[model samples]
Target: MPVHNMHERVLSMGSEEAGALLDSLSAGTADRLWPYDNWPPMEFDRPLSAGAKGGHGPVRYTVAAYVPGVWIRFTFTGPRGFHGFHEYAVLPVDEERTVLRHTLSMRVSGLARLSWPLAYRWMHDALLEDSLDLAERPARQARWSPYVRLLRALVTRVH
Candidate 1:
């Protein structure tokens, strides 16, 4: 199994604002940015910190590491085929400019090879773009194409 990675970044934010966005990745606040509002929101058994355990919907993971207002990584634990981590990071480019980056890197096995490309990849891209749009405020929403919408519809049914 080879690693499948997706990276999306949004610009023009302050580090504090970006960091706050990263901090908000927990159970209560994630829906405000991510497309979680339309799906099962990200959640955890405890506070957003290392050792916490949770994930969205049937995709389970653990809080592998976290740094308040900076970064947090989650290592996948379920769906039986994902192996790797996803992380949110805030990078300061200047006093008034920051970048919020989300990265998911994993090597899949078994059904994931087909499912990741045929299904999850599309939804993940749309959802990440929507999330970055939320982070990039004052900017328009990411244009969701009909294909993305169709994929969303299909995945929504599976959940």
Candidate 2:
């Protein structure tokens, strides 16, 4: 595990559902995740392991992560730096209800662990969780905004 990381139990929707949510969260930084953004999230591509479900089904993956200054390996085994390893476990809370457990883990080496505190700045989980319902369900009625063109400047590349 990395000297710094985050791990928390989040009540998820479903494997496929969560996968979609995961994809969307990732898309926010897709250009970065895929190494096409200004400050790309990682050094290389994050490869999804076979038999591990993801956008298609359950699965495991190893993603190279660059956390600001340090770089690390993330996988089911453990993360090696500031990046936290993640997992998706589907739990049957009920017949129609499933909880997607997304766990993030990081390895601690030396002084870094002593000084850095794990912080969840509304990352991966909360951000997606907020718009999850909106995304999962149908879109609301389209309302016209006169400043639609003006707002585009704020999110220059949202399209």
Candidate 3:
């Protein structure tokens, strides 16, 4: 069977930094890249245009979540094999280490999982991992201010 796989990566940066960029994602960003925006804002970032500043390759996606952050969701054809609703919770791996992981099947499973394979190959195996890493690296270092303001605005709007 072509397994519906879950791919995760830990940037050298901690969840704190990752969370910031993760929080920056909004309908604006999703409309530009993937479809849907109800999934929790992820600890990732994707740039709007090819080779844009602080952009990784032709795409840039970032997020900063606080639940204490925002909640967002979506669907897309990309690496990670038709990524479903992914969730993350930050924790210290060591006294000075932290990690964020992607949770698979939080939504859209069963038939969707079985059906995604052929059409979402860009989202599988080696290619999927690298594509996500492309955006993760730069977003780890992405500026915190925009993310800060963005998160605040989102929280205010929701409440």
**Can you tell me which runs of candidate 3 are displaced by over 4 Å?**
1-4, 27-84, 106-114, 124-131, 138-159
Give the alpha carbon lDDT tens digit for every residue of 17-127 in model 2: 444443433344442112112121322233333232222011224553422211223453222233345543444454444554445555445543642343222223332
What TM-score should be assigned to candidate 2?
0.36
Which 10-residue window in model 2 sums to the lowest lDDT?
Answer: 31-40
Query: For model 1, where is the 10-residue window of minimal lDDT?
Result: 26-35
C-alpha RMSD by candidate, in order: 1.9, 11.6, 14.6
Q: The CA-based lDDT of model 1 is what? A: 0.79
lDDT of 2: 0.34
Query: Which runs of model 1 end up more than 4 angstroms from their true locations?
Result: 27-32
lDDT of each: 0.79, 0.34, 0.38
What order do you get sorting by TM-score, best first?
A: 1, 3, 2
Please provide, for model 3 over 33-146, each residue's C-alpha lDDT reduced to its tens digit, 9 standing for 90 to 100. 121232233223344222212211222222222352223223332333333434344444654445544444423345546544533223323333433454364523222244
Candidate 1: TM-score?
Answer: 0.89
Candidate 1 structure quality by residue, lDDT tens digits, 1-159: 776565666577788988887777754644445656555688889988899999887789999999988888999998789999888888899988887878898999999989888877777777778788777777456677788788878866876
**How does candidate 3 fare on TM-score?**
0.39
> Which runs of model 2 end up more than 4 angstroms from their true locations?
1-16, 19-47, 50-73, 76-84, 118-159
